[model samples]
Target: MKNDVFLKKFRQTIARYDLLEIPPAAGLGRGDKILVAVSGGPDSVALLYALLEIKDEFNLRLYVAHLNHKLRGRESDQDQKFVKNLASKLNLKFFSKSIDVKKEARKKKLSLEEAARLVRYRYLENLADRIKAQKIAMGHHADDQAETFLMRLLRGAGGSGLSGIPPKRGKIVRPLIEIKKEEIEKFLKQKGLSYRTDSSNLLPNYFRNKIRLLLLPQIKKNFNPKIVDVLNRASNIISLQQQYVEKNCEEILRLVCKSKRKNKIVLDLKRFIHYDISLKREMIRLCVKELVGDRFASLTTSSTELSFDSIERTLSLIQKEKSGRKVKLIGNTWAEVSGENLAIYSRKEKQYNYPISFPGKKNLRSLGMNIKSKIVSRPSLPQKIKSKGEEVAFLDWEKLKGQFRLRSRRPKDKFKPLGMQGTKSIADFLIDMKVPRYERDEVMLLTTKGKIAWILGHRIGDEFKVTDKTKKVLRIELIQKQK
Candidate 1:
């Protein structure tokens, strides 16, 4: 029968992808639950019917989940009622919820499309967790994948984005990913099943809708007649290649990066620079993802989804800039060069400023270091008075005027070095010291009433140096905090 042909192809796809058994190794067995997301559309309705036809063969438990995004008023409500009635007719359990997508969009400062998607997925994830479902199935056919690929391509997305929607992501599975939308409609019509159509989908307000209603049809008519098929095939090939590269990236990430602290990941500059540019881009992307995992998931355009420009800016900081340099990233994240390590971390709200306390320990929270200052007699000082390490500074206590403050370098700042004859601009001093331009702003200055007395981690001011005439000595030591 014509009906039999459609069922046969559906079964073949399910078997090929091993969708019945989530892990494939965990063979389709008894008591297995699958949450089917029914959006009251042709694609989803067809998916539900196909699964129902073969549910007994796999001994599967099927449940329908729907979200009423209150965008179309009465039409949206009707969609929910339709899906509920359909589920009841099949004697299956149905779960549904209503949400004001417009309000959510305004509150989150996101577009209507993005807000709806975020709220929809969050609801499904929670429902799946509550029911302990093994998999959440969605109806995203090959046409959707092609549309997504083209959309991302137009936006200048890289290989990962070009791969289109994945077949499986965590517990979410798309059994219809390889099927065409036309085939789904044909199957629904053959089965005499009626479904609700969302009027919003016909609107050209959204980029995806425009692609689906206008761009795709034009491409098929004017360009390749089988544009969807060609795009889907390309996506499949790119998906496999992306998986391979991502696996290698994970291995390289383990070898080159370490979890330095909460909200921070450090990559070894030495190893990172050796990698090819393609690998470097992926590595940076992975780092950003790791740094902001799940935090921006509700946002439609995730900050983790770095654009080509953002990745290039980050790579410039890593490859070209010197140690102590940093660049800001999306999602309130940033990448910094700390010595031979590159740190990717979330931004902190705390300002990096603290006054130095004499004869006591003052914790510099921003720098993750402690300033220990002690006023002691000259004899008590170390005989060597080793000025080799910048962390330790021996200054004449009497020479210091007013209060000492630790702050970042300011514009046109001038400081007289301990050995230099005259005062030199901080900019010139950093250049002379071979400090990277990007890192110059981060250089800390120990100031006495706004006069630079010491360039922390670098040189000390000549005016503040302890001479033979000095009776009292100020021993300032910079101690790194223990992890």
Candidate 2:
């Protein structure tokens, strides 16, 4: 009777988790090498134990990586030791580290949570690369997922927020996602296993801990009794459907973002106005993620997901001004609308329009034309390239690099004009030439070894002005249809 009852409970838990292993073709498979990150907490410990139980069935090679954030001093070390002992007893390969997470947080000038998470993921990614592991398993469960969904919803999130934590992501998988906190505790009790409890979880200061301890419990008691289960079910359904939405989003994105080299994306407002709200939001989020790097920064809280910092803003800017307009985005990134397409570009890409390192032979493709160079006789350059008169330049022999850099002019740029005696600031020179407001900003400078040698389509720098001493000069030319 007891055996039957245990089996029934186990089966129910598996059903809830969606962890019923199918054939190796569908499921994670037996003996799949998985790296489990354990924190010695109840959830992670439970996951470790469960994986151990199924180790033989799965033909699994398991590795345990435990991080000691060292926030709690002795207690943190104790947790690390516990995980080490547990891994040792189970004969699992264990890697442990006591990281000075607080110190790193201070060094990076980031919040404690942000720094620790970044450091942890970086370490895990590095380990994954070294081990060539397909999956890195974490112990986030249903309760945590439910709380995350609720928190993101409160924080002005759309359906993407509702999607919550995934069971499997690239090289990262959460196998215990279907298990709830209560169910996990019950399983540990049934197995006569004890797990370390982090006192921080009881504290109401951390937003997540507070949700787990106070908000969710209150919701369960007064609002929804099976809230966790309902959320898990909703998340599962959402996850499956989101995959379809993601595929649609990818297709829409390909049409929307036309050029990778130009770093721009556009939602044909006419076409964008058609999709249903869910798919529309997903498309917007995915495009922003690809162009901008994170899904969190995709859109605003609205169903349209049209954030002020997104393609919507780029479109607005272009509508107001058909000329060059810049939108400074998150970090070192910016976006602008050029012609019909909304272009997303980082500040670095825009500011460093000049080549950073012109190493070796390069086929120049900027300046609305293509120009190729080879070490040959001075006569190799056609008369059109040689005597384009003021438009052509002969660079100094000593300054030429097999490899050089090119970039846009900076405020600090000052050079002595070839015929002039004094150093002239580029700022003054552009004013002297009466370079138009719009065109002036678009002017690019060719740089070699950190100094501007020439401004493309305009004038060569004073130092690079061909001198009598400069006999071996790099011939500059413009490819033209010869008359």
Overall lDDT per candidate, in order of appearance: 0.81, 0.64
lDDT score of residue 168 within candidate 1:
71
Q: 341-369, model 2: which lDDT tens digit per residue?
A: 44554333356553443223344444334
RMSD of each: 8.1, 6.9
Over the stretch 1-483, how does candidate 1's per-residue lDDT look in tens digits?
A: 777877887777777776766333334447459999999999889989989887777778999999999999999999999999999999999999999999998987778877888888889989999999988889989999998898889888888788788777767778888888888888888889999898988999889999999999999999899999999999989989998999999999888985554456778888888999999989987777766665433332533356788778777877676666667766677777866778777765444455776888887665767788889998876665669328888888898969878887767789788888988998998888977544455578888977888888788998888877888988888876533
Q: Of the candidates shown, which would achieve the greatest TM-score relative to the real structure?
A: 2
Error of 2 at 127 (Å): 1.2
Candidate 1 ranges beyond 4 A from true positions: 22-28, 260-262, 292-304, 322-332, 347-483
